[model samples]
Target chain A: MQKGEAFKIEVNELALEVTSHIVNSSEIFRIVFSDTRPPLVVIESLTNGRPFWTSVPQGRQKEAEFFGKLIEEKLKK
Target chain B: MCYYNGQKVSKTEFLKLLQLEKALKDFDFLNKELSTGFDYSLNAVVRPKEGEIDFDIVQMEWGFVPAYIRNREQLGKMRLGYKDSAGKFHPPLTTLNSTAEEMLKPGKIYREAALKRRCLVLSSGFFEWRHVNPLSKKTGLPLKATINYPYHITIKEHEYFYMAGIWQPFIDTQTGETVDTFAIVTTKANPLMEQIHNSKKRMPTILPDELAYEWIFGELSEERIQQIGSYQYDYREMDACTISKEFRASLDPTAPFAYEDLPAFELSL
Candidate 1:
């Protein structure tokens, strides 16, 4: 998906394989109650790999902020 | 400066390295090896009338310019070194990873190159990191460790290998000289690579010894890449051990380990 669009990620299960198929889907979840609401990201988690599903916003501002905090911490190295 | 499989090879060793041996004492060993890794450059501008293959070394940039940039600063900004490619300036999508599953479809640059302008990237070894331990819950410390792991799955000994690559010839907007740039093809990570490249579950599509030529010329059919994808060897088939290269005595294969140790983690799926 491009920068600001939201799409649902669908995970398929099979014998020994966990595949993610991005489905044609959308959601209207708002990050804040302000007039200009931020877009929410819906990412599907694959069962064969790491953690289960979690959503970040369409602009991914929170995710970006979290990553920025991580970088700042690592820079102290 | 890199080991193919496990054996260290120098520029002097390349020609002899290509000479594959059928068995010990085989007279045709040299010729067989030469045929596998050695091939002359073939491009529209360098097409041979009678058709000849001449294998030689040439310098090329690693990042592509898209044949659209007309500014020197913009071109320079795109130059990729290991650290530079990992920097904030480069977008995640542009950092040399576009999966075949995504690129095989129409309209992708990889699909375009695969259909028409396929080229080979010659290299001794590329790097991958294995997590030595899960991140410590208490300290929030990363246990990622760099390893000079060698490729040993498909060879009796160390031998140079080629990763499947595609290149585009672009004219430098300011210099007015033609330059070639390339990106390596990646696929779903094999079991051997899951521990390393732990962050991203992907690995480069390494061309097989017998199939390197076919892969380079787009002579390989879609069926071949698919079939080859199914044949990736397990980690057990490869000798995967972490060795330090940055710490003193780290480059020594016999050096004692100093990093955090964790139980072996294997990918089941």
Candidate 2:
């Protein structure tokens, strides 16, 4: 992915901006929320499509799922 | 060893200052305004994803709670410093900073996290204290009163920067709750830090902007990691000012005393 490329998704009143990049041979997705209390969620795919998520702030697990699904759907297309 | 750190700028200001605004896009998760103080939990910036070096500023418990601990009860016990069956008192795992030497060692607690979950702990500045006592002129003995000279240190050019860190995502087996935690990585003090943190002689790994990417994404060998960990940051690049001792007595983490400065003292033998 090119530098500075990003996309946005709105779900259940929460807006998430996402950017993808490859570091150390792994694809990493950074999802930033657009809320009063914005949380940053980082997702990396391991072997067999297993996902490794980091820094999903407290009380924001549902937001993570919504952002992940959006990213997954976009990747599928 | 950095017990107190301050971020004078809000997330927006930090992003703009670092030129990370384009990569981060928004700052909703961060606190709207700057809140500074000393605490066991801190809102730190991290880059956990590999492919793109972007920022993920999140609030993490400053102390590392190992994944094995099942509940807050056990965590509390550990925090109180454990006593073995043999009745010896051992220091509790107050894991605010994991030494660079320990992070690289095989079979160590931080080894896996060091290699995989590297992060950048953002801070505007950090606090350290020097222990000082005047010597008796004729007796050549130490004086009874010892003074702790506190100093606030920051990068001269940048308003904020990153400290090297490793993080873990911990799950409570009993409650099924997940929390992400991190510990700042420390190394032998640079000349500037040694003078301030006189007792411990250690300093947090402050990574320069140019090397932050390599720290997070580069495939580093053991030798390379050592070089990066122990690299002596230029003392001239930092600005350290002696601050009022009121910071040490204040219970409020956001106390205004942190902003007060005292006359600078020359370092001596």
Candidate 3:
């Protein structure tokens, strides 16, 4: 990773880190973004189970959505 | 100083992460091969702010300074030794690394900070010296040498690792310069380190991922802190390589240089 210039940093806390993995004879690069304490939205499942998903705060909603789209696009590739 | 460290984070990523573009021009260090010794040196350290679970990556001076020192001059005197009114000359104070067992004892200089100001020191690797008294060709007696072979040690497969550390903030009364200083906590050496750092028989408290997290966020009870502070990172998980005697000046400081006469380890890795 050092020679390849691959790097990973958490948006939640920006420590200088890099992560790399080899998959299917090809090197895959990923950047992981996380929130330390994210606001969660709880939803009632059909079987009365509570499932929670993270919510993006004001002004950062666009960044959250952008990352969501980026992940989706990467998955499609 | 046991922890002669290498913290080689590039400037571009560091600025982008910290959003410190304004300070970019003034930025230096974080790419140093060896970052601490008798003199002051800078290294990237992870410190948790008050009321914050997550930590910020900040550059802190490696030599710890106690808060009671009056000013910058006093700090110099305290570190380099100053003769007392009775004209007794004291030795230079070494605060680069603190003994994990002794740091928390009552009335200790590091006691208060160890309890409240725990932090993690980030390192690409650290350097330690091994003394080898080679037999003299003429007499077969040992020859005197100060620093023999130098070893650059790091955790295996870990690009960078965290060492347990305690930080203190110093405010200079004369210059009003407020800077964060830290001391790496060290414990009794594991077998591998027992060979490499033979003189001191001590090694930095390199924390694993889980323990590193708990050390920063766990309950601050004296026992818990001391337990983690005294952790001896398993020798099997470490990688030690002998570097050139001129490693501090070599282009590739960390590249392994094999010594033909370096003794084979009796203990298995």
Candidate 4:
């Protein structure tokens, strides 16, 4: 993303395009949000050093609990 | 002057940044989202026992408060350190932008912090405004009023910018909680800011990327500190476009003032 320009939704697509740019060169860009209905999300890997994405179950109480469980489960590995 | 949610922001933006609800809320959910790198701590970074720097994440309060006040009397004796309200301490030291001059003063609160407790304030932008008219002298009608005219500017950018600052470790002798507080640093405005700030002054000295580490730990020498004034960033490169009055309305609910295409206020000698 350019310094002065504001972020727009379409420009924020996951796939890379020739003209697209990331804001401020942040090494880690994680976008975690909740969507109730499924197409249960998944990620394989990256083509370049681009942004990383993730999705988890969404809820007020459930979101936090799920996040904690995910971390604990990951740590067990 | 600008507004957020229709209210004037004379009280300063520190509290708004530190609020837990706001901090936890993601950027896409809000009108703006500031990136304060993962390591950025807005509050106290709990030091690991045995004096080891854990680098573990912890948040901090947005503003600096010295760690020693135990009672009302102790808080009362603390200097409120604003250039304007130097001798008086009525409003108390809630939030403030510090100064390079104050940091160098032999026995000032800032000087001591500069030597031992330097800190970095994180933000994406700040607000400064140009005063068109003075507010009522008696009523203190608007914060925009009292500032030195022509040079006085007001800002309400719906954005964020990291400000250079310092912190002190405040230990509660009673509760035994060790909390850390901080202050922002202000310097003479750059040329462009001089035009908008109108008075050749801007608060919260902005540091460059290269100087980040040096500024935090390097020797507080006369030559090194002078760079803040002599070598400030180019103020002109940052452009100023008229922000929408609707945005202004959201910022100052009480003002209910509409945006007018009046001539820009000029600096008078």
lDDT of each: 0.42, 0.63, 0.68, 0.42
For residues B219-265, what per-residue lDDT tens digits would candidate 3 score against the true structure?
67999898999999999999999999888878888999999987666
True contacts kept of each: 0.00, 0.00, 0.00, 0.00
Which of 1 and 2 is ahead in lDDT? 2
Q: Which stretches in model 1 have alpha-carbon errors above 4 Å?
A: A1-77, B1-56, B76-95, B132-156, B221-237, B245-262, B267-269
Q: Which parts of model 3 have CA positions greater than 4 angstroms off? A: A1-77, B1-31, B135-147
DockQ, prediction 1: 0.01
The candidate that wins on TM-score is 3
lDDT by residue (tens digit), candidate 1, B92-206: 2252544656655766656665555544554434455554445667888865653333221232233345556656667756778777656666777777677666778687676
What is the lDDT, from 0 to 100, of the residue B126 in candidate 3? Answer: 93
List the candidate numbers ranked by TM-score, top first: 3, 2, 4, 1
Q: In candidate 4, which residue ranges exceed 4 Å CA deviation?
A: A1-77, B1-58, B71-73, B76-95, B134-161, B217-222, B229-231, B241-258, B265-269
Per-residue lDDT, model 3, residue B68, is 81
Q: Candidates sorted by DockQ, descending order?
A: 4, 3, 2, 1
Residues B1-269 of candidate 4: C-alpha lDDT, one tens digit per residue: 21222222211221221222233333333223222222223543221222321111235545455545673245434444332335643544644556676566766666666666555554545445554554466986644534322221222432333356666666656667665666666777666676667544564576553354345545557657646423455453344443333432244322223345334535341
How many backbone clashes are present in model 4?
Answer: 44
TM-score attained by chain A of model 2: 0.60
Candidate 3 falls in which docking quality class? Answer: incorrect
Estimate the TM-score for candidate 4.
0.49
For model 2, residues B1-269, the per-residue Cα lDDT tens digits are: 00001223333332332334323443443322232322555555666455753456666767777767778778877777777899998787777788887678877778787777877777767888777666777897878887687777878866566788888877777788778878888889877888788789998888885566567767888777766766557787887776666655555322334432232345542
lDDT of 1: 0.42
Error of 3 at B265 (Å): 2.1
